[model samples]
Target: MKAATATILVLATFTLLSSGKKFRWCTLSDLEQRKCAELSKALLAVLPLATINSFARVSCIRAQNTHDCIDKIRVNKADAVSLDAGDVYSAVKLYGLTVVAKEIYEEGNCVFAVAIARRGTLDIQRLRGVRSCHNGARWTSGWNIPLGFLLARNELLWDEDQPLSQVISQYFNASCIPGVGITSPQLCALCQGPKSYVRNKNHFCETSSSEPFYDSEGAFRCLKNGVADVAFLDHLTIMNGTDSDQEEYELLCPDGSTAKLSAYGTCNLGRGPGRAIISRHNFQKITKKFLTLIQHLFGQNGKERAKFELFTSVPFRGKNLLFRDATQHLQLLKDKAEISHILGLDYVALLKGLGHEGSSLDNSVVRWCCISNAELRKCEEWALNIKSDPLVCVQAASMTNCIELIKSNEADAATLDATHAYIAGICGLVSVAAECYGEGCAPAAGRTKKLTHLADKALPPVYAVALAKKNARHVNIHNLRGRRSCHSHLYSPGGWLLLSRYTVGALENNTVNCDIGSAYQSYFWKGCMPGADKNLCKVCIGGGEMEGAKVSSRCAANHNERYYGNMGALRCLVGSPSGRSFGDVAFLEHHNLLKNIESLQSSGWAMGYTLNDFELLCLDGRRVAVTDWADCNLGPVPPNIVMTRPVTTTKIYGFLMKSQETLETNLDSKFHLFHSQKYGESDLLFKDATQYLVHTSHLDYQSILGDPFFQLAESVFNCTHADILEFCKQDICTS
Candidate 1:
């Protein structure tokens, strides 16, 4: 494993660093490429605002992977190479290199190297004794080894220290010169498309190695024509297709959202040693220059990337899952010429069998569909009736057109299924209807007449309210008076109203919290989108299906920074990352008691306080809920955020502590969907699950369980110890 013979002369060809030009990192796709474009926008903005031309140029560079990028970098081409996180370490190791700048683009090593070949050689599976082409011997030291990989895959490895054409002759296998590179051909392949690869390469083959394919264009062409079933490519490469060429991609960069590639990082760096960089000086300069564009990283400039983070994380870690606010930090990196996040997403996915796709986050690329069958049927049916000569053109699969239909009042709403409802609802659309199972609504009941586009609707047990910030006003938040308030139901009507003032104020002050400034969910759940409306909802959760959970609507704008999804975010604020560890006094205060109730009662609302200080409220002829719980402090090392709430007490009862770990365990699939989570239960939700917790001390749920949802909880409540056995009666009932 030898390196370059001499210390490489460091020269930056990018005008951003030398020609006094800008730095650009381009890509294609809605997530990665969009993120790069967004970040680039911010860097561009930073120069004029800060009055600094530190970066001669700032732009996105589009390449296949790290190797190609490093090669380009070696030629003093691109200032910095943007690769995924996990592979960065590996590529550095493989290429035996170091880092200049880093940013956590994606969270994991999802990228895999695939061997590709002409259709005749499609069986190029485990290239054992068969001819194989790869970057040469010297490069394979820390990277890919054709022979070894073949052995593992149960194939033949016919590796030889030679160029690709020669290896093809001797061993019917060949290797690209180690570090000699494949980029040139990759580009050519893209232009010719896949058709040419088959006719040209004759018997082409590739080794699953790393990224920045010198010949990505070539490989793309090979795969396109079916010449190659698969290719040694990065995850992003497969996702974005290709820019067609350089200048064309640059045009798309400024166009928005279309420029992203893969979401997570890839791992195929040809199994390199370690990566090296030009020198620390260049690294420092790049870092310092990028740090100034606080807005790009944290602001609207990088929205596409933020959208990816939001979408991927929701399924990865359920809705109530917690994570530290990365907004501010990301915003800080905007201005510089080139910035990257080396460390990646540390959180792992809690995969749920989520969609039409299986519970395979790895094999699947989640796409939130904006239209559903029922809705599409309705649109077509109505299209027949309209008879107007307006352009009825649809981008076909365009979410933009779908969103515009609702926003511009051209259409009443957009519709989709439950699993996909999240996509429409997340950024900014209402899920007026609930998430429902797929119902083949192919043939409409009223074929001749236009009908409301509603599918197999989940019984509307719970509903969401969505609104755009620019449209609505009257947002508010309680003074809180330094009191820690655990405000759950972030987008709930009551929750939104309560937090409005604070959210609006935050936006006024330039904080990202209210970036959208007091928007509503309008039957939408999971999360919110940027420019959505209520009319977009077409999810039809028709009446009773699976039992909905027993939840209470409580309000107060509290604990924004404290909890995520429902988990703790930071250990503490105003200190080192770990400085604000839980203090010992949180329990003794029992802040959950009458403290807030007393304050509320003092203000006028009357309620009967009960054991554990539970309080029930009577507003207008119906009973409302109000309960108190202790706020967290540092005492006892491990602190339990005392539980007390009016709505559903069973879930949060019994020692649910004030730590992120506890939240994860409780909200886990087994314990959630509104089931009891026990005190001191370990990570697993199965063993020692808590049963029968107090819903509310003051109001016996059985008294007036008027709501159908309450009726179900009541039904379960009526069940006795005998009933429990009967319900679970695994006994063979042979009658």
Candidate 2:
């Protein structure tokens, strides 16, 4: 009888104590559970002395595991509970949840929601009637937080130890009680702790018109259903929108009918709040550093505050597991200015070839920097491969620095250009498979054109931002002002034709050539740090980005040694003082072809250097007339050193396909031309006769075109070495 009477006394005290207008929870929910557990002995330092019994059990739930506590609360076993925000619907269709409004706990990770609806979907006058159908209610992250916020607004309190019926009666208007309906009690009960719940529908609720609806999601649905004249709420929904559902919402903010949004209001206010707590023992033993770290970590700015839900799947804490909802590719799109890119290697060439045909390809490609030599072999085998899309690899690189260059706009667009894709691969980024200019291009600075390996069908054109042509006409000249002009340094068609022309045109043909080298070097080390660590692999050095310069310098460094040859930067021909000549460098190097051909033009001088680079010296104007040199014989007569040399156009292009190979066979081909030849060695090598002519296969011309042994003429051109080589050989030699 004394125990029963004691219980009655306890209950009576709680009732009378909670009846007044003030209700500040002395004890919170989630924290109380740990204190009750014997396992948390040392950690539960909050235990009060003097036999203080906490009759008011906090109903707070820190996580789903706290549902057991919520169950105890529902059966009158405990006082109140706390929960996080996961129980809400955050999908495309944001739903409305009718929950108790009490602000118990808030933090960066989770916040207690007061209420939410699609933007502009709620009416202020109609907010009182929602959830009139529930007997008792369930809770979510801050069902209690919101309750506290609102009840505090009206300066009311729930009668303590009283049924919720009696508690709510004191706070709510008499008429509002009969109309109260809860969001989802069943789901709320089932989702015990900090889980989220969607109140409205499968899709997010839309605000229509200028009125505040009681239940955000449902109010919007009600507005759409025409039950209400206007709907207004929060959740970053459109303050103004043009979409179908957007038309239904008309914003109602501060100052009643005024259209402007004074504050983000409920949308911005209910965000998670931060608090400082540690193990009770730790709290008593707080170090300044620990407090500082916590303050820094939970601060109101930076990535920690971003609170990206789906992005947090992988905790970035050295866990080797990757979690992504990759089931739907298109659904991942966000309404932000972001671009998804594709980056890889030589494979980008294939993507680009496809783009040249006016087909839709990837939006962009990195560069020909990602393909490994081994991958090149695989590419050869998968020449016609439709399964291994280069863009897919490019997409993978978009995840990091591996993606080299990227197009400016669009958050989720796919990059299709192979060159761009390869650059992405080198940088380690990811993007979707794009069918852009880089799509069909090889990851390497491979074929500017398509390959016979792939099938005939051309790739589709990639879509990109299109500006008015009229605007382009006036602004075309300003394009390079602040742009980074780039190209391979060693001579090639791309380097020569486009880059050289641009350089020569910009800087003009200068004698010192200082500006010319400066311009090209700008591309070399501008983005590169001085004494740049060789972060890039040689395999990525096709067409001599840095390799061409390095090779020339190293070889020039050692000239007298047995194997010490000269400039590997070019192919050359030695011209004798007697006006006779013989091939010096291998045909593949072709520097000599460009070097001294013009020496024989007007004066026929055994000149030291012919600095006139690919100038249109001899032109009929009908087409371009050049001294052809690819496959044609060094034409007729007694080896006149200054006479225009002949070459083969078609065969040279074919040879180019085989020229850059590092194989011994290709090496033999470079020397075979010098070896099988019949010539007086000294006439070309020196003014004297009979030197090393009768020895091994024609004095390996590769060695003869020494860095300093240039007895002929040399010149620089405004075309990539490949282009100049192909242009002169095809146009001049094919004749």
Candidate 3:
């Protein structure tokens, strides 16, 4: 059984390696690129050892640095690259790369930051004047790990008035830290520069092998050639670069004990994270196959272990590339989630401690808002339009999710109805803009001018009218019993709210229940009230014939609900299922009557209905024209308001306000920004009737909804129990 397992592993490796696919590996230097090409050929040759197989190809791409490699991968220009802990942090957070494989060493997957010195030349403590050699500044092993430990242990005193590099330089008599430039001269004070400070020269301070005293091997070379007393490097470098016969180098253990190079793991200054092979998050399937094949051929017990030395041997002499010199094997990583698992939290924190200045953190991009599946298409279009200038993006879910998104900093702004706006205010989100109807009741020149044409301002309330077939004389205000009805969602002001007030207040002698939803459900035989409990969806045929989950799903509050918003309710009124479940009346906004008449042919549900087919039910007990809503409408409600988090900066506000200007000034014929029909037949992220977005910066929730209207909406929202006067107040503000 075990033999079969081993054979299967080997055969799988050979088969995948011979697939003839090109795997591009990113490298920093030409030498490394050449080495990667050689390694690729060697890896391909291993498949033939067991039997003939396909030849897998490897291509090397050159990048300026570790960060540049991540950028290349993000745009799909390159496939994969190896990165240190700091670079891995940037890759995951900024470019969304997945860590596919980890480079394992002899002792374990990780190597430690170790300090090496000639015997008796350096002490664990009280050696402030000793000279030092480092691989480079900003490196995990050479700088952050060791220096951070010393500062934490109080062995090194930090001077607040001076740069950290200056303090470190003052502590050592002379030091050679490659990559430290003239910005901090103290850091470059002891660097012995070559004639031109170029490659293939001695004593040039650079991160690459071009400098004699660069990288881990170069730092140790500074000590070997008697230029510096002590060198800071990883255990792998000290062991790989030193001779077996040489007794000059010793590791400085944290316990103040000197040990042989073999004992460096326990005697190290601090443990450092290993390098990771990263690819785009979406390329996991292919990357996994590639990683598995490489591990099988070059692993500790592979057929070509000696001849190719894919993992154990250095492919190039001058530089590190493709894989590090001492890496024993490549171990597969489960996901990007393993980044924090492989690199301990302390080490990860050490990398993030660099702060957000000039790092991968981008604060300039503006995050737009979205809620539910209905708005996804429109939000994505908006995101694409402002992709460059003051870049905008959208991410939010349902109305409830949008409130949470604002609180969690995931989204910046959303446009909502009066009821939803009030809920957002209670949740601590404030209204930033109000929807202007452009009815010409107020002038359009000033920013803070009073909106005269807007309804539900504590003046005359926006009307909510009931619609029924013109010939349905049997249904009336007093005898509306056991009739199929349609509503614009459960919480909508025009639908559920107005009807609740009528049933619980005006018909007090007949209405018994105080729970408005329960009362409505019992009053109507069966109805389509999206966002209602399951019992309310009993009669929904889901476009008159579909059954089971389809009908059930069509009863939700979001776009999935077939009979959800204003247009959906109108569709329900005109919709009939071959003499089966058709709504007798529809409770919706008065203006929707006109929209329904115009869309009779394009909208499938209103197929047989005409402009004169529907009539409005008046409180005066008369059926009137759909245009006679002014006298028959229930009451006025507030318009939708755009809301956002209470941000201290004007960045988000400026983005939305600018978008408002572009949308209003240049309304595209195919795509109206404010009344966006791009997503569906109904209004999407913003209301369809919206003429423009008006800035209401200084207005609070009370001011936006008007004081009288705020009180009315609050009473309806707080109505939890049964009492004719308590459930339905007569003074429910007319507006």
Candidate 4:
């Protein structure tokens, strides 16, 4: 009767405590319920004794496990709870909870996670059909560390559409995973129902201590008793559990190194940062004050340490409550950002690995990125020749989109024009290979000996040229103002840079408009500059967009544009009827016009256009014949460079180097590997006039293009407010 009265009195006291005024501390449910009660009792005795400026009364709340406690904190049902490193990641990402305090242990503030097996019984790669034991799903020492590495190597299959827990169950023959949901029977197949709930069979695999193999010690015992062939647990648990018989177990490192359990710190997969006390981001100050007060009274040198051994001993009969066994005290963390830095990037990778399963990008394939349907067709042929073992083409909407794909680990490499290369370099991509152009009408056979690696040779500059009809109304370069013009794309060196330079130089003395993008929009009467802003695209005939694509002229950026690439720009110069058909002048590379003009001028050609009618726009403002291009063309432009992210550069270099060897050796084939013929276009991946691919290592934007040219490109593009210049507001390469 006296015990019942005391319990009633405590219940009434808790009922009077408002959530806003008191800290609701959460602990693991059931057996840990008494531990929660004990922590509350310690806080009651310690709050008055500590010298903290702000006093916070702490109350205890029981939750199913660490995740449940996190959910409680997220919903304001509880204020804080100490959790494992893996659980802290979930709480931070899923609920935006912040780490207020970290638990300090005697052995170390951190512990390594390892895979253990009976000596000579298992290896990391040969565990396909073996029974497994885990401390729990998403645990740092058990699941995330070891499993994250396996998933990265594709040793285990992964399917993101299905439950990650279900995928794990399918990988192992049978497994005991405590705290995993019972929605999938495969997860619960090997579980022996806990003794506490014999009638509820499904509750056997729960995270509570009632389950046979639920925690670090439980998982080790499961392996010891022959319930599982391999067990995932912490180094501390393995060292303590196997101390009685050293020869009974050995640690399995992914590198195939095996050693006694004591060497686990060195032989383990990875070390997880120690458990942390987390709270809602807003309640950090109050949470820190309450924990500091409790740590002072129950810490190693506390005066009232006898009331509750908060750090020295496990609270009550449970192994952990607000603090773990052998913990010295709690250390306050500044903020969530500091907590992320303490956890480190590799530990964050392990948490991310939990969500990824057998993704195709986790392979050795050199994913060649394409930005258009036309380029994709050519990429498909390249994929077929390589047979897709180590090389495959992945497509995105634009070059900028392709760079983003590399950042996200989706695509690997792409052949980018110099303009795109500058943008890619700003995004931290490295130049792995460059298209080497020499004096050749086509790639010469038996010239494989001259093909040097990217490091040995530099790409020859290609000249930019402006073309116009010999008998056009606007006769020369000086007459470009108020006349119709055409361009490949806004960023193309030939189409935009050369023309932009002339426009700015011609009107430099005028102060009406300093903005180049706006100036070009108003300068040209009506033009088909494929990728320009809406005003520049008003005269575009709308054939550039993909079928079923949105009805917007700005979408005419890639091959879909009537005047897109060098070839597309040349085709635009070959006029059509209906008045809006063609521009009076076209800007493109010198070689692109040479390859297509002879054919377009032939009566046999479908367009009925003649090269005889076109003339070159010279620097002296005079029109010249096609044969006099060497004397009339604009500045020499930088060549295309094969680029990939720095992380994947080496792997892609090896793959591309070998593919280039095969293509050069078989250069005389009816279907040329270096050139594309699908849409009567010769160059898609490499220039049709490209003699070979030059191997380059450790080459950057400023190095390959030269500092002066890079600055010139930067300045020229800056005139029109290029995205690359904006992205390079600071030196992203050095940063």
lDDT (Cα atoms) of all candidates against the true structure: 0.26, 0.24, 0.64, 0.67
Query: What are the per-residue Cα lDDT tens digits for candidate 3 across 1-735?
Result: 965776676676556555765567887666777777776777666555544434445677776555568888888878898776556666776667778877877666666888888887775664477878887766768777777667544455553334567778878888888766557665555556564544334334655544567677778888888888888877777665446414777888766788888787578876667677889887765677766666655657765666555553344666455677677777777754645455554454445433312333224455556654556777666665542335454655356566555544556667777767777776556666676653542335655333223334432235688888898987766566678888877667778766766655522424355456677777777888876765567545543343233644566666556566787787777764354555888888865458757776665545666768888887767888888888888777777887765441233445666665554455352445655444655678776666555656445677777765566566655543323222123120111
Residue runs of model 4 more than 4 Å from their true location after superposition: 1-361, 387-390, 440-451, 454-457, 505-513, 544-555, 577-580, 601-610, 666-670, 717-735
Model 3 TM-score relative to the real fold: 0.46
Q: What is the alpha-carbon lDDT for the whole of candidate 4?
A: 0.67
Q: On residues 1-735, what C-alpha lDDT tens digit does candidate 1 reach at each position?
A: 112211111112122354455554423222344455544454445334433354435665554334455555544455554333333443343343345432221322222333434333334333334322332222222123322333222222222222332332343232332232344343122222122244222212221122222233334444445433333433333344354422222111111112223321222322211112221234435533443233233433433344333212233322101111121122112222221222211100100110111223321211111222222333333333322221122222223344333322233233222211222322123322111111232235534211122333222211211111111122112222222222222221222222333333322334433332222232222221111223211111111012231111011111111211121111110111223222110111121222332333332222332233322211122212222111211111111111111111211221221111233344333323112122211111111112111112222222211243233222322331222223222211110
Q: Candidate 2 residues 1-735, lDDT tens each?
A: 955754454444344333432111112222233322211231123223321232232122322122232333333343322222221111100221111211221111222232323355453333443322111122221233333333322232332224334444343223111112333232122111221264222111111111112123333444455443433223322332346654434443322332323234333323322111111111111222222221222223212324321112233331101111110110111122111111112112212221211233332321121122222232233222222222222222221112222221111122122222222222222322121122333234532322122232332221111011121222221232232222212221222222333334423445444243344443232211111113111111122222233432221111110011111111112222343321211111122333224433432234434433221211121111123422222111111010000011111122222321222233333222112112211111111111111111111221222222111112232321222223222210010
Measured by TM-score, the strongest candidate is: 4
* Candidate 3 weakest ten by summed lDDT: 726-735
Superposing all C-alpha atoms, what RMSD in Å does each candidate have to the true structure? 25.1, 29.1, 18.0, 12.8
As a whole number from 0 to 100, the lDDT of residue 389 in candidate 3 is 34
Judged by whole-model lDDT over C-alpha atoms, candidate 1 comes out at 0.26
Candidate 4, residue 442: the lDDT equals: 36
Give the TM-scores of the predictions, in the order they appear: 0.26, 0.19, 0.46, 0.56
